[model samples]
Target: MRRRSFLASSSVLTIAALALPIYPARANEPFTEGQTAVLLRLVKDIFPHDALSDEPYLAVVEQLASAAADPDFLQLLREGMSSLDGAGEGDWIDRIEADRIAALKEMETTPFFITVRVSALFGLYGNPAIWSTFGYEGASYEQGGYLFRGFDDLDWLPEPLS
Candidate 1:
């Protein structure tokens, strides 16, 4: 096969794998499948990037699941999930997007919200695989900075002086 065809096929397979919904069932994970699903959906709501897939958001859930193995974190996470479920009418996950965002906003000062928000900042943006979605090319200092790269490639911004 030609190199171009091989690369294209590989890209397709990678996206297919990333696009699959995750139901984490690792040994010693503290969360139930239902809780994990809720966490996944919550992560997406927290970071609402339309162009990105669920893989990175699920990574945050998995990370929280692992942390929950510790007794203290486990309690915090359980309470957090419970709070989220109680934040809106019916089940929190089934609520409309606007309602969900309002519920989250109400909890902005809570420990759970702060923890998840901080974790998500790193978990979502730190994933190199999804960097292309935001037009980021990873660290550029090692490559002698963005001066010579596409630093000026953002067409949405006004043109720079020559």
Candidate 2:
């Protein structure tokens, strides 16, 4: 093949590859579809923010899946899934909201539950996109602080004494 043709083709291929979404390559998937579904449900139930979409919860699960690459973490997750599934009637994923909440409450003290709770807290709330929904404008330090930026805009408060 001509050098020019080869270079052009290679460049095209490189650009195409770069344009594609790049997810971290995992040698073995951390969770099966069922497990992933359960994780999604579990994280959503943990937070129960009806205003937010599934994207943030999914991100949390993805983060957890990434952490599950470690053998120990994977084992913990698998065991946790089993315990959750066994705790109540049928699969935990199939349970109604009340049942699921009850099941989660039962396992609240477990390490697995704690890990997921902390992960959900940071994953769901830490996302900048979520901040707007909660009316959190984020840190004001970068914008010269909140002193001049509606610092006294609390309409719910009683008027201050002169």
Candidate 3:
């Protein structure tokens, strides 16, 4: 096969694999589509900075999906989503202004919220696709590590006393 076709096929497989529930799927809950969507929304809400696009945010979605494959973690997510769904007079995601704020405040300390929040903090910000937006060159280890790369290349500091 041509290199282009191979790459295309590989990308398709990768996406399909990501969409699949993690191995050893829980017999209960089983990570439904609504639950996954809720997780994605939760991650985006927690990191509501405009600098990022939805692409990098998928890292958080993937992490939460994997975690949900664990029965206990799935329970946390289910309950959190339950609380989230019941938070407002209408749907939590659709509540306007103060209503949305109130809903978020109510669920801020929930296990699902905390789990998704902590996971997104560690998992989302570090995605390489997110780096270039802020002029980050990413890890130096791959380029013979940071030492040879002159990580402390800043020249703005005043000269040290001789």
Worst 10 residues of 2 by lDDT: 1-10
The digit string of per-residue lDDT tens for model 2 on 30-124 reads: 89889989999999999998998998788888877876766767787889999998998898899899999999999887767866776566667
Q: How good is model 1 by TM-score?
A: 0.72
Q: Which scores better on lDDT, 1 or 2?
A: 2
lDDT leader: 2
Model 2 ranges off by over 4 Å: 1-28, 155-162
- Shift in Å, residue 91, candidate 1: 0.5
Global lDDT for candidate 3?
Answer: 0.63
Off by over 4 Å in 3: 1-29, 142-158
Q: Write the per-residue lDDT of candidate 1 for residues 1-162, one digit (tens) a residue.
A: 122232234343443343233335344368888888888888899899999888878888877776565576678678988998787788888899999899999997776776676556666776788998887788778999978876677899788788
Output the lDDT of residue 35, model 2: 92
Task: Return the number of clashes found in candidate 1.
Answer: 0
- Candidate 1 vs 2: which has more TM-score: 2
Candidate 1 stretches with Cα past 4 Å from truth are 1-28, 141-148, 151-162
RMSD to native, candidate 3: 11.9
- Residue by residue across 1-162, what tens digits does model 3's lDDT show? 222232234343443443333333232245677666666677777777688877667666766666665566667677877888687686676666567666777776654555566567656655677878878888776788767666667789985777
CA lDDT, every model vs. true structure: 0.72, 0.75, 0.63
Over the full model, what C-alpha lDDT does candidate 1 score relative to the true structure? 0.72
